[model samples]
Target: MKPYPFSAIVGHDQLRLALLLCAVRPEIGGALIRGEKGTAKSTAVRGLAALLSEATGSDAGLVEMPLGATEDRVIGSLDLQRVLRDGEHAFSPGLLARAHGGVLYVDEVNLLHDHLVDVLLDAAAMGRVHIERDGISHSHEARFVLIGTMNPEEGELRPQLLDRFGLTVDVHASRDVDVRVQVIRQRMAYEADPEGFAERYADADAELARRIAAARALVDDVVLPDNELRRIAALCAAFDVDGMRADLVVARTAVAHAAWRGADTVGEEDIRVAAELALPHRRRRDPFDDPGIDRDQLDEALARAGADPDPDPDPDPPGGGASTEAEHDAPQQNPAQKGKPQAPTTRPSAPPSATFRTRALRVPGVG
Candidate 1:
């Protein structure tokens, strides 16, 4: 079925902007959308895919990553069907390949297995997938706008995977009765006639598509001044984010924002908006800490950074790519175990008076 138009969605200005910024500069990585159910998260991703398809003139439609998908299915493997049918050992492209130049939509991303999440992180960081299995060595471009939607109540992504996403938006169902009624009306109209409803907003979507293409062209050329870079660094530092990913994402996103606005140079507004989207998820110091940015703090940090006359750039700027060794090598934990209490370590009843050739025993393990 055709998706409801992107422009037609109401009351998610931040969500829409995050998606658009990633579209403008995919190097900013992609957008992770955190919200409760029935908030049009999937709808917006599909609509963005539609816009990308129309803009790029490629089959840039949405490729969904099902919660239960296996690594081979998510990344590509030997084509067993072809091998059986014609005795040809060909490779069967998976979701990553199919998602190239498009949007890889992962719904309930928090429910995905750790291995699958790792695969996504790798692909998002490198813009390609490499597989060496079944005596088949294969690699292909897998660049796409990674759109992950999750209900935080269910679980949380590991900090490594979370940091890989350039932007994050926290959305909620509108509480205003009038706005809720309008949402219902639009949804009902779309359900009643998807094509007709889509046609009504076709012009708007087309215009957005054009703008996205233009922004992509301009993003690289958009100048991020030293002052803006300092502001980004200060914002990340103020947030006390653990690594350099936030700084790079904010910088890239600010440039994208400038491009999206058709500006030749990035301004304070661009940096502020970028920090709002890029720093929220990165602000959590630990798994238990809540994911969000304090707006007043963000404003204060930006003001202070902007006021300071620091001609020097950030002392320790990250290398070209967004990926970091800490992020790449971070341990993966079961998503189900996230946001829950870990089993307590057992204490010895008494100090071991004599430890002779005893196997190293930790203690009673959780069942």
Candidate 2:
């Protein structure tokens, strides 16, 4: 089915950005979208899948985990059909296997059974799945982007499971009349004729995918300067986030944010944005303390860390083509170095090696 176009989604810019960031670099782990029923959480996921499909030229299958799904069905199970037909007990892969290299989205995740949540958390953390059931043992790589949606009114997730997710984005229905109207009109337009609506935004979706692809290519080169690393650690310390995961994730996320903006290195601006997304959920929980950051304090700390305040130009728009690497011996796509090349430096010719060595043997006292 054609999904509602991502660009057509009315507002919730942060929600949309978090989802896209997770997609661009799954290593940042998953994003937990918390909101009420009509906040377009699931719609955003489907749109992301569609966006990935257009970007990578594959379906980018989105495997939905049903609330009532059994444990065996979720992890893996014995192949009854294979056993009966061939007299052999084979291990049948489950949702985790199918979700490899795609997305595993669970709506109402807070309401899922404790066991099920544990299973997912284990797989997500390990980046692989191993199952032993009914005398069948099998293990294989299973890495997929994880997304979970929840309504706080329904329940709360375990702290353990909540921290498993790399990022969290709280969403609510749009209160602005114009935005609400646009959301409704877009929904109606999509429902009225899904194909046409999708087709209308095809170019924009493709552009978005290319932009993500370029950012993915460029992310590895977007280094964090020593000051940025210090800043990341300082931010984590300020929040009193648990473990080293937040520090490492914040560093990597700053790199990604810089890459997304087509910068060659992580900067203060990237740190601010990355900290907002990476540090919020990881903060020590206090009922009285706000879950978000203190913008003023963050700015002060960043300045004290000697962060550069220079603003960069907006990144170039993605071109209409696949932004993939070339094969061996072929020229690199060099997405990070997309726009320009620097002037090459040259060295002056040196004197003959034998002549230089003989002449350098004289001591200062003798001379």
Candidate 3:
């Protein structure tokens, strides 16, 4: 398929940004693009593959995992011919192996089989695959940046699998008539002259590639400040999110974003953007809310955690004297009413000791 240039893609800035962030820091995990049909979801992802290939100076190691592939095609199995003829153990690399140190794109991911999805999760989490099937037992590195695109109308992804993605972007179809026209025009131009169209955006693609390389080099050095850390934690706490995964994702994503922007230290704005992407999928109770992360609640928590842009000179602290006064003035309830059983009025005597006498023995060989 002919892929449009990454620079020429119409809308969905967040999707593009998320993909670029993964390119910069693969450890941030994969990205999921959720949208309607014909929103250029797959096209944008392919374009990113092209850019990544050019930037890394390697053949675009892009491997597309079709939904109809069998288990052997994905994780590999024994080579039947070699095993039957010469009694030699031969191993064949599968899609996951081919995608090593590259991008693995999955289309209609929501409709994929549950078992296959579990395999993907294992590979993504462990960065390797251990196959012990068909008289074969071996493990190989399967590290790859996973990118999945799905249309919500088709099906819903399981919550456990959805939460594994580091970032989730909801893309909308372009509504502006002119923008849509431009999209069509560019696509036609690319179809008419693929080489010319690619060349037109060559410079822009090169610049983006340079930026990605630089950001990756600087990502490890980007410092996450204490205030930002507290803000991230507070947001997770206020959202009633489960586990520490959300906090970790937010912290790493913010650092990558800061590095992308050529900043040495992560700021409040970086954390806010990261939280918007990472915390949305983690809303345990309200998964379908359009605005997953409550902006007002997050804003309040940020202010409380000293991440507010315009802070009051003396905002009330988290554990001020007011809490102490409230604790003291609060009325005490009876032990029974408080759901606590009253202790025995007198302690019971201990059970009688065993009648057996104690004896000591020393080894003759050692002191």
Listed in order, each prediction's TM-score against the native is 0.81, 0.79, 0.80
Return model 1's CA RMSD, one decimal: 18.9
What lDDT tens digits, residue by residue, belong to model 2 across residues 96-159?
Answer: 9988878899999998998898898788767899887799889987777789999988987988
C-alpha lDDT of all candidate models, in order:
0.86, 0.82, 0.84
Model 1 segments beyond 4 Å from truth?
81-88, 285-291, 311-367
> Judged by TM-score, which candidate is best?
1
* Per-prediction CA RMSD (Å): 18.9, 18.7, 15.8
User: Candidate 3 at 299: error in angstroms?
Assistant: 2.7
Q: Rank the candidates by lDDT, best first.
A: 1, 3, 2
- The true-versus-predicted C-alpha distance at residue 297 of model 3, in Å, is 3.6
Best by lDDT: 1
Off by more than 4 A, model 3: 285-288, 291-294, 307-367
Expressed as tens digits, the lDDT of each residue in 1-367 for candidate 1 is: 7888999998899999898887777778888899999998988998999999888888858888888788888888898888999997899899999999999999998888877887887888889888999989899998899989999899788877887888899999999999999999998999999999999999999999999999988877889888677878877887788879888888888889899999999999999898899888777656566667777888899888878775665545577544555567888889999999989989869766875785765678854
* lDDT score at residue 6, model 1, on the 0-100 scale: 100
Worst 10 residues of 2 by lDDT: 320-329
What candidate 2 gets wrong by more than 4 Å, as runs, is: 288-290, 307-367
Q: Model 2 clash pairs?
A: none
Q: After superposition, how far is residue 184 of candidate 2 from its true place, in Å?
A: 1.9
